[model samples]
Target: MSWSITLTVNGEPRRVELDDPRVTLLDLLRERLDLTGSKKGCDRGQCGACTVLLDGRRVNSCLALAISHDGAEVVTIEGLARDGALHPVQAAFIEHDAFQCGYCTPGQIMSAVGLIGEGQAGDDPERVREGMSGNLCRCAAYKGITEAVLEAQRRMGQDGWEEAA
Candidate 1:
């Protein structure tokens, strides 16, 4: 049975016929929709290469089923820009040199956006590190990534001081 699924992706309405209940959002975005920014690193939720925003929360798209997210709002790396202007996180990544080889950058930026939106980027490098630890970068650009997130938080009027427990 083919089920029709409607979802808002990258601020655009997308409707597709899903024939497999086990097909994940990542596959739908990459294979079906041709949105290939999200990589398939681990494909088992162990790596954050497929991270995306599900209604403003960060989730591993590889573990999220397209059928389960019917009518849901999904944001991928392709949605991180507006009118050719980069999102603050994207700019921060570039300005801070947060990525090398750039395979994990999309997921890293997506996770950072969610963290900042949740008020978790309050100048605490440790917390930022902890929050972003799920997204691994084989290039070992942790310092740049952390700096970019902190810079973005500061730009958003955060105190830039370590968050108090």
Candidate 2:
């Protein structure tokens, strides 16, 4: 059986036909939509490498069934920029050198965006670390990641970062 799922991806409306209900949101994005920023690490929800925002909440896309979110708003790393200016989180990651191998950066940044939106990323480093624990940096870039999140939190607030929830 084929089912159609409509999603608002990166502020654009997308309609996808799914032949399999088991197709995950990750595959829907990477395989169908061609938005490959979200990594496929672990694919077990244990790693935050496939993190994305669903209705403004962070989720492990690899574990989420695409058919289950028929009309959801999904935000991936590819949607975080506008015109040429990067999102605050993206800018922060670049500025702080928060990534080394770059495989997990997208998910980390998305998680950071969600963290900021959820008001979990405060001025405290420990708080930010605790909040971002779900995202693991195999390159041992935690210091820069923590610092980037802090910088982005302040920047997003100052820039009035608001998106469809």
Candidate 3:
């Protein structure tokens, strides 16, 4: 049965019609809403490539049913930047060269954003590593990713981000 859900995506209200309740948020964002930043690396939750912020929390979008998150505020990597300025996490990623293939960058950025919001991504490299363990980078860019998250955390406070909410 088809259903409709009104979600706040990237601070904008989005109303989507779903033909299947089983449809995932990843598909909804990529197919329906055209927010393809969240990749489809592993459709299963094992890969954090489909990570996104849902109601200020990080979740594997591939495993999240769109209907289950109706009315939730969703934030994708595309939504992170505003007014032509990159989010701190984004800028830090660029500075640290956190991505090689760029396939997992979006999820990494989103997960880093969520990690910061949850007050878990600290200046400690090990802490950031543990927090971001879910996002796997085949390029083995863990050093860059860890540095980026740490730098972002040091440079910006949780309040500096609106999309992370």
Q: Indicate whether candidate 2 or candidate 3 has the larger lDDT.
A: 2
The candidate scoring highest on TM-score is 2
Candidate 2's C-alpha runs over 4 A off are none
Which regions of candidate 3 are displaced past 4 Å? 158-165
lDDT score at residue 41, model 3, on the 0-100 scale? 95
Question: Which 10-residue span in candidate 1 carries the lowest summed lDDT?
Answer: 156-165
**Candidate 2 C-alpha lDDT tens digits along 1-165:** 899999999989999999999999999999999999999999999889999999889999999999999999999999888888788889899999999999999999999988888885579999999999999889999999999999988877787887533
Q: What lDDT tens digits, residue by residue, belong to model 3 across residues 9-127?
A: 99899999988898899999999999999999999998799999998889999999999989999999998887899999999999999999999999999999989888864678888
True-structure lDDT of candidate 3 = 0.90
lDDT of 2 at 43: 97
The best candidate in terms of lDDT:
2
| Whole-structure CA lDDT of model 2 | 0.92
lDDT of 1 by residue, 1-165 (tens): 889999898888999999878899999999999999999999999879999999879999999989999999989998887679677788899999999899999999999988987885588999999999899999999999999998877775643432111
TM-score, per-candidate, Cα-based: 0.93, 0.96, 0.95
